[model samples]
Target: MRRRPATPLLLSATLVTLAATLALGSTPGAAAPGTQSAGTQSVGAQSSGARLSSTPAGAGTDPDEALAAARTALGLGDGAQSRGPGQPVGEGNEATMALRDLRVALPQLGAEQRREGEALLARPTDGGDDPVGQGYDSRSKKLCSGNVCVHYVTKGADRPDSQKWVRKTLQVMNKVWDFETGTLGYRKPVSDRSLPQGKNGGNGKFDVYLKELSGQRLYGYCAPEYLVKGNKRLANGYCVLDDDFAKAEYGRKPLDTLRVTAAHEFFHAIQFNYDYREDRWLLESTATWVEERFADDVNDNRQYLPVGQVRVPDEPLDIFSTTFGRHYGNWAWWEFLTQKYGGGIVRSVWKQAGQFKGAGRDYSTKALTKVLAAKGGFSRNYARFAAVNNNPAAFYPEGASWPSAARIANLKLSKDATRKSQATTVDHMSAQNVDVTPAAELKDKAWTLRLTLDGPAAATKPMAAVLVQNKKGAWDERLLEFNRKGRARLSVPFSARRVDAVTVSLVNTSTSFDCWEDQAYSCAGIADHDAAPFEVTAKVFKDK
Candidate 1:
């Protein structure tokens, strides 16, 4: 793994000790069972919207070909027979019975859902109204066997696209839910335009509505419009996407992308189902980690493949500019952390999260630091992702693992103990600063520096600090800057000979103190106690 300026043994040691104490309180779980997690809840199960029903257009009600296909995929012998109410047909797993019953009862659907399903299915199937206008619908009910059943109200010629998606969806679920740890998957018919916008076009997205029954909310782009409309009871619900992007990325043809999306969403589902709500970073990071690590794209389950290349650029700011690199970067962070430690550690944190009304302040940042410290040190976490892609030069000061894509490949990984001089004194600051000193000394070779304020004035008229250094004989300021709540000691390339010493100090660029309402201040003196110092022979490495 790449090596950077190590965090001060004192700071790391302090954090580790604190984390160990904190982890003793952590537990594991997801959202509480009944309270719907953020997003829309499925209320249709309470009452059918249209009050509709279904029947065969002419004679045979059975979808012979579709049944044959489902049977083949299920590996049930072709001789599999359709049993009536009390007749036992096949393996008789509660889940299978739930599925079979759902298939048989699909003709009776509520109005609104059935209408929407028909319209969407109509567009893709390219067929005129069912020869004489016969429609399909399913009765929505919780079976005695205890699985949620959803049937697509069928109308017109059964669209091949819709049928194919339905079969694939069931097939995937049959395998995924084989563990049957409480969550169950079954199709429901819907006429809502939003229904089919998920993983398999209209055939799959409606699962979110079903998720509402289980109380899982949605986030991302789909939040504002659908999730938070003022019903505090429904406060946390919204869709991440109207449709699953993986399917779109697969070019619209029915593909196995739905399986991946199922795993992705269900991971969230399981978490929501369990109320595991502590640190959002741990929650999201772990979800992403599991998605990439568990997603399988091949026909045989033996071979494994990541869903796609980590879209490192798309991640939120904290993960990219601060913690990990980008999309793949964050996943890499969690993946590394999990591999080194174990996933059970996350469950421990999740138990703590559920107790929170909401994760307040820099919850993610603090949580991670605490978790790392509790588990001994951040080195284990760092070592996990950096194991293969070690970079040398820019490793120090922490947060080095999360750089731009271009910088990731050329990472330098080397560890040489050479004496070098650098500076950590406050470079430039005016007298208007508060109680602290204008300058400070930072001796630790650590890269990311964090500072916490003490006084009320410190909190009000906050100060800002920047880490500047000389690179290749010339002075260059990096974009990594911090305010009162936090400070970062950066480790970029430095030159000892060209420059005498680098400085760590406060800079007051803002003149306005009028915004001091939250005990806010724009300028203050820095004590300089923990300001990181410049060094000559620091060790660096690039393992990638």
Candidate 2:
């Protein structure tokens, strides 16, 4: 769950973890003040909202203030937060993070609020002081297998209507553990044995608790229990899942919802064994991608495609959206990498970001660019990916089911005519697609389309890709090089009979970020090279 609009928190560096399905909140394309080189048009229907109930009595609860409250709730303090009953989130994947943060921030909360936080952090089953919230159901049942112990209620609103669901959940989890760990080769979630026998499955088996989570509009979430001593990241953790994913509420068969959520939340547990403080974007996009690897049949995650990179190419790949944003929608990113380089590439990224002894200990983007260096460089591949989104139906194997990327500018070039566009600004790690159609007059075989782009300095990593589609719908792609001055030119067939359209995808591949300033993006900081401007000109002429 990614950070949904309102309703929760993100445990900061000293205690980072994840929730599986928090919807995002934000003015779709708004950049933080001073975080961008320029600004962008706010596109799409997504906007930010603060749950009135989740806001404390006296907190400044406007859109901006709520975002700050959320960030502060995330432990990224923008301003001092007044303590009351720990502010509870309305809905989101921030459930676990807020749950955990509430535990730590309890000292500053009022009596009633502190009690509320304590109750949520309570363990559901019998174990000394194990991870709980399920409450001790006298009829609580336990199912242990392979490397997990699942606790569920036998009766009550929290119980799965049948024991069959329990067995199925465990079976699915074992399958997930095998594929993600044994097959994919990720580190196992660290055991909680230090917590004492039976408490938090101290015997070494990871634990999963079942409860009615749909009430909160969440699928599932995981929480870190302890960090590697001296390191502020989790080495041990546990997860909680919806008892039954009722179709009426979740819009999926109970099993279908269970399959995707289990795969998703458990991966967060697996991540705990690595580094808990990895970038939210990477943490989420990759986790969402793995669900495909484990349960390709479900396809439940496709709902996110509309808000993802293919449809909203303007949003940077690494942005950790404040509300129901693209982290989940952006699964296509990892899908692109794994499909092209095989799943092992994703594992390699984790290894680089992992904080365990001998792990690379790098942050998310750094680990990503480094791993990509061996595969023809990061900017090259990223630009290619953005351009590919322009005509997703042709590029992605499942492209037919995906939406095409947005176009920044559209033009039809006639014989001996030229069109110069106003400067279009794009965000860091984002792209702008310009489509040019050859007019009827340019149908002659010898015609050529001349293209030029002016952008920020090469240090900003401005680059472009020319995608030429022929009448037969065959597509050809080529990368354009921008010199140190950030200007580049290319020419391609402009014959209407031979060419359908040419799309020039202008990309700002800059990865520069202001680290630890607590902005909701990679490095928890804003972009140092965002909203850079670019201008493209297209012309058509006939060769004698």
Candidate 3:
């Protein structure tokens, strides 16, 4: 989730009470803008719409006015509220309003205003203004240890307990950062003091804030500001937390929930240090995945597993959306990657993404594709990933051991095939598996199986597959890609000794990746897979 700058405000009486309990010191300075040394290298600027900028430009010179215009343009009322802490942000139609606003405002805006609006559209809203007019406590005390410095406003009656938890969580996060940096081959965080003349600032040790955030449900967020030095923009990272939420969620425990949230959000800081220009899915997915490593007991990331497996199983991993199914569900892809190639492979993918110097957006898929190509091309691995997802536990040892994976039911296959053409529907963002074993007489003899698939004729047609189990129990799979006519065919030849049972599956490919409302499908509706279901026909014949 993205965090906006909190307006300076007075602390509540509870903060004073907590401050007295902890004997806290004076508040630290507000987060400074990022700064880079003259000699430090800078990455190239990415085009708009390609990457999610950490320090997104405000709606306009007057943020309130711009936001009002945006709201009016999108036809949304002002009553919409940001998400609560630990909740999925920007899911469903919430993002549609922002996207549509940008589309409407872009043409009317002047060159400068257009650029500003575009920047705002590129990332999730930073909890607009502080909803609690109390403003953040500028005098919040600072506690520093290891690589982290936590700034917090004293609140509740658990100051000592909260402080201890914060320090421990930061320590855990540091350990994770060190491990990931070593494995991924990325640069470690460093301090810098050179800043541009404008509002942009400097970078230094990681900063954490404990305050009352604007969103009721917003757990916390990492805000990375930009610093310019001779046409180069660098990133400085900081985190904001809802002290109330932390106290409420974890209470007096070792702050388990807070620990998980810190791990997830801190990784976003680490990602900014590498390349904030990377895709949002990659940043969030990897961050979510890291939480499992640091705090496996939390199991918060598992909340999205069903989102990926059931809600949108047919959606391609590379597609982009602000929905929970797209962002959180992305952990599944990383989980599969970790299972297949080890955690280091994920690091390698990030390493490539971090060092990207090419023009335009270097998509996460492209980075992953480059890294995977060394072992095998992305297409081959992707197909394997899709197959493994069906029975995640059966294919991966780690998966088999985890109850989360074991409990998930793989798509079922049809019991028997009919002589005449028969059709079945696979929901959008979903998959269907059908088992097709020939009659006993037909199995031992040489025979041919013909399969036909008909679906929407989009640029990327839906994918179909035929998997056969050989005598040795190894699975042989063939992918089916439809033509412009939304039709695809696959012919499988079976011999008595080598082949046993065959399985047919279909994946719905309809999505909002490149298309918006102008297209026939709405971005939000695509998640439901509301379009026409594809038709599949299968027949078997004795070979000559």
The 0-to-1 C-alpha lDDT of every candidate, in the order given, reads 0.27, 0.68, 0.49
Q: Please state every model's RMSD to the true fold in angstroms.
A: 21.7, 12.9, 10.7
Candidate 1 C-alpha lDDT tens digits along 1-544: 0111111111110011123333422222122233332222122111112211111111121334323432332223363333344332221111111122122222344454333222222211122333212112222211111122223323322222344444554554444443223322211111122221321122212232111110011111111111111121111211221122222223223344445444444455344322222222343445545554445232211111121112221122122111231322345455445555665555444433332235221223334545667775432333222222222124322224233221111111222322222222211111011111111122223322222222112222223222233334333332223434443334443222232233322322112222212110111112222222211112232222
**Tens digits of per-residue lDDT for model 2, 66-91:** 33343443233454232223232222
Error of 3 at 2 (Å): 18
TM-score of 2: 0.80
How much is 5 displaced in model 2, in angstroms?
32
Candidate 3 local lDDT, 184-220, one digit each (tens): 4444542332322111122245566665432433456
Worst 10 residues of 2 by lDDT: 37-46
Candidate 2, position 527, lDDT: 88
Candidate 3 Cα misplacement greater than 4 A, ranges: 1-134, 155-161, 189-203, 212-215, 228-233, 244-254, 309-311, 355-361, 398-417, 420-464, 468-502, 507-535, 540-544
TM-score of each: 0.36, 0.80, 0.62
Q: Mark the regions of model 2 whose C-alpha exceeds 4 Å error after superposition.
A: 1-93, 96-119, 126-139
Worst 10 residues of 1 by lDDT: 211-220
